[model samples]
Target: MTSGAPSDWYRWIPEQISARDYELLPEDFCRTIEVVDGHIVKCESPSRLHNRVARRIATHMEAGRKPEPCLMVDTDVDVRISDVPLSLRRPDVIVYRCLDDDAKLYAGDTVLVVEVVSPDSSFHTDTVEKKAAYAAAGIPVYLIVFLTEAADGIELIEEYRLSEGRYHLVCLHTRRLTVDSPIPVDIAFGDLASG
Candidate 1:
């Protein structure tokens, strides 16, 4: 195996960056990186199918969302988990409260977070690491979308709810996703697939 230090712009990156300082980074540069414990972690570009599923889910959630809570659905946005050590994650889809100003979103503002499992994604990171982090951040709901064996579309969705400072498996939806907490949402897996 060939091994060498990262070259070019990567070499110039500092060992760690605070959440506040991370915001000062170039928008384009910040788009492809996530901060974990103040360290920069490069994010891989997800497949088109992954993006499509996330977008469809977001669309469905927005359409069925209730008006009372005043929530917003967005895709690929950073949710700051902590600032002291600077832990942040860019979830595939996020449901957050409507903010007055266009500022950074904190975990407290988040209602639900979704992560679509791509062929190249690490199962442990999606199911364990991110789940634990989101729970610790006090996000109420977490969804993990599993792709079909053929990688053509969504196959299953595991919904978890935070209880007593930890997430518990609340529901599993294979054909149709329906959830009541955080907001009522109903989305068919078939609709999330590309034609």
Candidate 2:
């Protein structure tokens, strides 16, 4: 009912949430939380360092993106993967090859989806359930940027590409090791981690 009540909204399916009901949600909740398969999943906000890195990446990519455009950077937007009668999820960052001008509630298919890993988030679900969901939804690229440790720790990046009805890890690298994906874009972990 109300965000403060903390009812079991997680148990609902996408079809269960009506357009009218979704509008009743709280306005000022700190972290991003979404309902998927009736489960309430909380998303992590970028740390000052994480925000800096994301901005840097966006800037670099923005400079290189051409004609067709690789993707549009949405900081924190709600995306509807499926809606039947119950659940939903608003990922941290969604990169779409095409930006929707009229979209207010949510957008359609996205090319790449990225989530800067947060220690507070339920890593198992994000890395497992949501990953599978994105893959099933046929998202071309999924990037998980790890920013969970203290002491300015390791920045692990894993890039997954969908193929043959599933997602496979195409590349993996740490901040100490700079690596490029077989895809068109090159992400420098070392460069991103510092920012």
| TM-score to true structure, per model | 0.90, 0.72
> What lDDT does candidate 2 reach at residue 160?
82
lDDT of each: 0.84, 0.61
Off by over 4 Å in 2: 1-16, 26-31, 44-46, 104-108, 148-153, 176-184
lDDT of 2 at 85: 32
For candidate 1, lDDT tens digit of each residue in 54-142? 89888888887888789989999889999989999999999999986578799999999999987566577899889999999999999
Q: Candidate 1, residue 23: CA error in Å?
A: 2.6
* Tens-digit per-residue lDDT, 1-195, candidate 2: 454433654443244455445655554541366766544555555577667656655555554556554456665666667665335566655666565666643434577776666656557766988799888777777777777454544457787888996889987866542323212455556566564
Q: Given candidate 1, what's the lDDT at residue 35?
A: 91
Question: Over the full model, what C-alpha lDDT does candidate 1 score relative to the true structure?
Answer: 0.84
What lDDT score is found at residue 90 in candidate 1?
Answer: 95
